[model samples]
Target: MFRAKPTFVLLLITFIFGLIPWIKAHNSSLSFCNRTCASKHGSGGLTLPYPFGFSDGCEIKLNCSATGKATVGEFPIQFVNGDGIRVNIQRKCNRSLKTVAQLFGPNYAPTANNAILLNNCTEAAFPCEIPSILVQTHFSSVSCSDSNSTISCYSERNKRAFIDLERLKKERKCEYLLSSISAESLNTSEAPVSLAVEVVELGWWLEGQCRCDVNANCRELVSPHGRKAYRCNCTEGFEGDGYKAGSGCRKAFSKCNPAGYISGKCGGTTRIVMLVGGIVVAASLTISLGLIMCCISRRCLKWKMRRLTKRHLSEATGNLNIPIYSFKDVEKATNGFSDKYRLGTGAYGTVYAGKLNCDEWLAIKRIRYRDADSIEQVVNEIKLISTVSHPNLVRLLGCSIDYGEQILVYEFMPNGTLCQHLHRERGDGLSWLIRLTVAAETAQAIAYLHSAIKPPIYHRDIKSSNILLDQNFRSKVADFGLSRLGMVETSHISTAPQGTPGYLDPQYHQNFHLSDKSDVYSFGVVLVEIITGLKAVDFSRPQNEVNLAALATDRIGKGCLDEIIDPLIEPHRDAWTLWSVHRVAELAFRCLAFHRDMRPSMTEVAAELDQTRRSRSWGNSEDNTCTPSSEVCSSSSSSNVSERPLNFHKAELAGRRELLTFGEKSHVNLAQHILRD
Candidate 1:
């Protein structure tokens, strides 16, 4: 009973010792061994095979989100189709004219022959081809390499010899070559386009030592020389290539010859040995997998418990009538307020697109670092917004004040802000009809706040940015943190002037009296924005035209409103279109009047817009034909634009007289310019 068989004891010891090194090598070379097996899909949702996978078998590591957004290393990939890939200029090399391939991703090399380089220099010091320091600076035709960091100018197309990069730096007098432009470029083009691509796409498909056939499984063996040996085996139900490439893999059935077929059968002793070896390996692997799974379960349970505790605490302490969510709930919905979920940011807060449910999204405005004004505004927003409900107004769904964070949740507007549309950032420009409709709808909403409410609400911040559009392109006014409730008895609210710079009321600024007319003035500015399709406050303009309100007022006064109108709307030159446009101009002109008393109410403005839409102004009010210049009114009535704080009473009287006179002098010029057939 005590005696162990000598042969069995030796066999067991040998197997155990041999298994240790095999296991270590196998673990270390899992990636190398399974080199051709697909690990992941590339960015842009292309299934990455072999050379493009994430481990030792692949040349590139790529990840793609469900939305088809892809990324390579630290750079967000614009696209990836076969060997060609597009990545945005990486953050580090965004301003750098000389960029490296590493910033885009591994295996990427510069496509230097197709890039157009531009520089930010005040003046050109040398005789350049482009002459503006915008590309073509020291143009001798250029090219680059995957390993070489210095970008040099070459003498001719298809030439390998490069001009010394250091020599050009000392010779040129402008800012060093600006960053490469364009997402794509042709290699055959006369000039170079700077693009980055994988230096070689199919470098990882070859295997080392082991010549594995297609669909073959390979493993590693540890050797005494501290080297690894690869062993290939035909997948189950197959034969050959179990160790090396001396015989390639074949189907078990195909291995037989029909004439002299003999099934490769083993003796009883050999079968028993093979069975015992397989059982030992399988049992060991199963035990190891079970241990791993158990450890994972413990972590999952701990996380689940913590989540349950948080939910329990949120319910017990949060005494809110409005739907209140836990900090964790908000975090999970927005993926911890990730930048990927962000919709836009403003002075008040950053709005993130959060999934409260799988079907719908909520615009979660998070004010993480709130100052005193913002905190007070959040409180005011909650109180005021809760009481209001209008189709044109954004609905307040819920809020969270957990962990010192002020978060307001709103019905997500799929379409972005009106500003994005007005600026033509949404691919196409809004049609004239759509612009007019937006103006009318926005006016109606403001009119509702001013006239329909018991105590009228003054929307102090009535800029295009605050106007959000829905899926159907229907507009709604949002961001009520700057709103003030008007007292029915008081003519004006005595407060410090607060509104967007370009849209702020001039009268309010002069007198510090915020009235319903202040909102009207801002809306008037928006109307001008719609009409001109220009920024209300753009510093990238001449001094006189820096402020769009002032510029529009100047242009309208000079009887040259046609000159300032957006080119997109220029095709509509019908009589009705002209008359409607003229009427709209007059309305905008009146709304932007210097005095609050002089400005029309939002109700009157809304009514007038609707009426104009109906009439289309085929032929009415010839007085509008006058030069339409507010500047002319200033001159005739002895008023001056140079006059700081215009005399509203005098200017108002002059405006009336100017309208009555209408285009006596400049009208002829305007008729020629505006009503050209």
Candidate 2:
């Protein structure tokens, strides 16, 4: 009997394997019903439905009329002579031909909008009448005859089948507009069943459909070939009642977690065995790999940080230390350059009140080397400033060039930088007249550099902080760190991009080519700042809306220039003063034009400022120097020049001397002449 046990198991396995195909076929029916996988004539989703296809192969055209022709939705529909049924295909609503013979019939027109009528047809043979075209685009009427024979087939011999002639005739006529048709000869197929019949009946669909099948429900039988339709009750976990007696949906076994399975069949011992096995494997791998890497990285980080820290500390604090001061010397000065004894820092460097060897009060700039591209630049600055002399330019007293440090001493300007008077609030400041005077002095200084100096020095970085106010409130142009001297022949020089961001010239920013016009642009930005009391680069607002120059220009155009003008300067506004200020703004705007060629020369800018000052009676003192010499020269110029004796020989000698001195640089001057001669 024990030997027979193994044979019994083999036989059982064979029986299950043999039933698989039948079970699958039965199960497919239980899972996906006719409604889920409707015939090709049935509508699916999207465009046209499946099976019928879209072109001539289908019984009905996808979007065509009943006659199967191209037509819009609302129109007279052509008809095909056959039973038709309306069905959803793809996502759109459509009609389809049920029979293969009907699709190939003469009533079907491949090019026509809908089907056309065939002669000699009766209502009894094809009960369905063809739909009238009315306004429908794809529908058509069909004609059928009474002599048509209905074909029927059955797998079971005992089951009698008969065709309804009257219904067929009516349906064929109506088929022109309908979607799907039931034919006598067609066969139905289904998938296998897996579960007990009683469980399938408890499904939601069966519970709703079967009043008698609350505990056990009946489902409609679907045919496979031509056997009689049959029904069966559903089993547990199955949703719908089965169509056949024994075949129905079966509960699928959950193999993922056997103990937690709905049909439970496992234990805690198996789970613990797997858990321990996984932990041992994971820990062994992790410990071996981690220990090896940890030792290597721990040594590397310490060495790297020590090297980086030493390098950075040297750069930050090594060269920036102040000179050693004896206690007595420090006490004597400041009253030791004390808080009260201090003068404010300007563009040149910090200004401190200190007592020198002669016990003289002087403002000392303890300059540290900012960036002396080369040791040669330190020599160049010392040589350049020592040789050049201009009344309006701040004078360099003495320099200490030691090690990597360079210091320049200058006479004190007690009142501080022009930025404070123009931009500072509170009581200690200049009035309107003094402000105008300062602006005039600053313009005169720039003009002197542009026209009077030999080979001309451009104060490339010009801003309010660089303009220092003396005790007399006179403007002195200071700070030569970013300054450059142009040879007479070279009008522009290539340079690295460097400057305050907002006040930087657009041309210089784009091309890194520096010219005198770039200075004009920076000055323009500063002038706007003076007038508006706004920062050149303010990012407190939104990211998209930057650019102070464009914003101010927009306000000026709107006749709301006063809205942007500093409140401190508001009380000084009058018709003539406003005109003069607007004139300056206009010049500044021109100076700030994107194209360097469009901006006025620094000489012209100075001339414009001088003209405005004179015309407005601003700073008219003898020393003001804001008056235009052109008016005086123009009125008496022609007769006086002709009357005076000519110095032609002297002029000739001077011109020759100048040419020889300029040498190759003369070509640079000629280039500028070609541009603006």
Candidate 3:
């Protein structure tokens, strides 16, 4: 039996006993161990390795040397498909035997008659592996090293390897070859290998299959030594070192970098751009809103200024002396006479520069009066003014009656009043043409009042102070506070003599009878004042020369009209101009005649002055002669002035038929005393 070793022994035994059936049977069984092992498979459906298989055709995935010993490999052990993956033998000793076992293998399987058992087990307390034996025991049938257990034959050298039990028993080896159940062997999901096994193998132990593919394992099996160890395997359809990375079953997936979405949906870059764009749009809108607010604020400020202007205009218009603004039109223009739109003030009530419904401006005179007498006078004056209309007249716009206050509206005269031009010394240089235009215009207006209007109107207060100039310097007769109108054929308006001082008719004052000649007397004084550039009765001047009319008469008789004319007239230094002025001066003297019949009518006087202005002549009309008056004159006279000493009565009748008429019996001597010499 020991003539040769195992390589030669198998050949010699096969040849020498080739015809012996029992010997051939044993040899054939030995041959079968070379290829396969026992017919029944190992646990986990895998046939054991050579000298350790459970089927006729299974062979270990390891090289056998001539001595029938397994060769070593890097990671030689691996579980079959559907087997709880684990190494086949003690990991260190069988490094070459590339076989694997189930997680619930024969070592800890239950025995036939109980709940725990072992493979090649002889004693219940100490299980041992035997190369010649197969185990079909349940994992829960046996308990080791306890009472009621089988023989306690423990040996350490045979603990992990397949230790042929007949050899150990014959060699009488005991304590060093013993083995015990590992604590991790009870974990059903882990194989009987080390805890360092791949998760795929552990997964297989739990699910009975490999979860990884071949190329993914990187030629590195993860199974190590001891219980709970399992073989490494990469996941199907993937490739990597599953055990090293601990990603045992990574599935194959596409890799992309700097690539777009296949469906053209928004990418990361596009999303970022969209977000930034949205932010920019939002910021721009915010800035635009702020700018709009600033513009709106400026616009609001301008509107406020306009509103303030309207308010001031309204306040002034409310207290004007004249009816400068129409009630309906002004109220409609300024939103119902609202207090929010006042203008200015003066001696009258508030004066307003009002815009009419027709877009024309007007000066509104609002006058205040509590007494019934004053109110009656204002109403009467308004009625008289309403009855007349002339270009030279200050046109009445309308009137307002509200809250016991009277308002007269008139067309706006942009050039202001003649008083401002004459006495106020406004900054604008007044040319002689403009001044003469004012005088000529005033004369024409007064003449029109005395001649044109039916029954004739007499402007009792005919002073530079009562004249207003338009933007074109056209003079207008304004402020008819003392005007009167009645039938010319009859006596004048039956009222107390009412007129400004120095301009009042002396004849009308002594005898309470009004006549057209009263207006002529006033015109004479105005003419003297205009030529001399002096006030009618200026108390501020030297008392001897205080009365402008008397001073002019004295100077004229002495051939001193040159010394009395306005100094501002020196620019027009022609003798013809001086002669024309002297002629007008003489006519003014005649108009102031003390004899009522001798005084020229406004028609005669206006016609003579017009002709004199046109011709620049000194021709004498019968009614117009420089006859110095001997007595005071009534400014209301436009026909005849009462004379003192000169008995021109039959003499005046010698030239004119109507000499001593109605209102002609006044005492001339008394009139002379009051004429302010």
Best by TM-score: 1
Displacement of the residue 67 alpha carbon in candidate 1, Å? 60
Model 3 reaches what TM-score against the true structure? 0.41
TM-score of each: 0.46, 0.41, 0.41
Stretches of candidate 2 exceeding 4 Å from the true structure = 1-349, 358-360, 369-378, 402-404, 425-429, 488-495, 541-546, 557-559, 571-573, 618-677
lDDT of 3 by residue, 1-677 (tens): 56658879789888777668877787777555333222233322223321233333222233333333322222223443333333222212111111222222322221111111123333334342211111111112233443332322223332232223344344432222112222233233232222121111212221113333344432222222233423344557864434432334444765332233323343646465655676688888878898999999977875665455335434533432333333455566656655654444443355566776667777776675646665555665676666677788887767755434577777888776665655545545455445555666677777788788777877767776677778888888877766666464265434445666567666665555677788888888877766666777664565456566667766765656767777765534543344346546766776676566677887777665654454322323322222224333222325365332222232332354221111223322111212221
- Please tell me which predicted candidate would have the highest lDDT against the true structure: 1
Taking the tens digit of each residue's C-alpha lDDT, what string does model 2 give over 102-181?
Answer: 32222121111112222223233321111121112111212123335221111111222322223334444423223222
Off-target runs (Cα >4 Å) in candidate 3 are: 1-352, 427-433, 488-495, 616-677
Candidates' RMSD to native: 18.3, 30.6, 55.4
Residue 99 CA displacement from its true place in model 2, Å: 64
What residue runs in model 1 are displaced by over 4 Å at the alpha carbon? 1-321, 488-495, 616-677
Q: What does candidate 1's lDDT look like per residue over 360-460, in tens digits? A: 99999998575778777876777667767778889888877665677888999998988999899874888777778788889999999999987888888
Q: How accurate is candidate 1 locally (lDDT)?
A: 0.60
lDDT of model 1, residue 265: 43
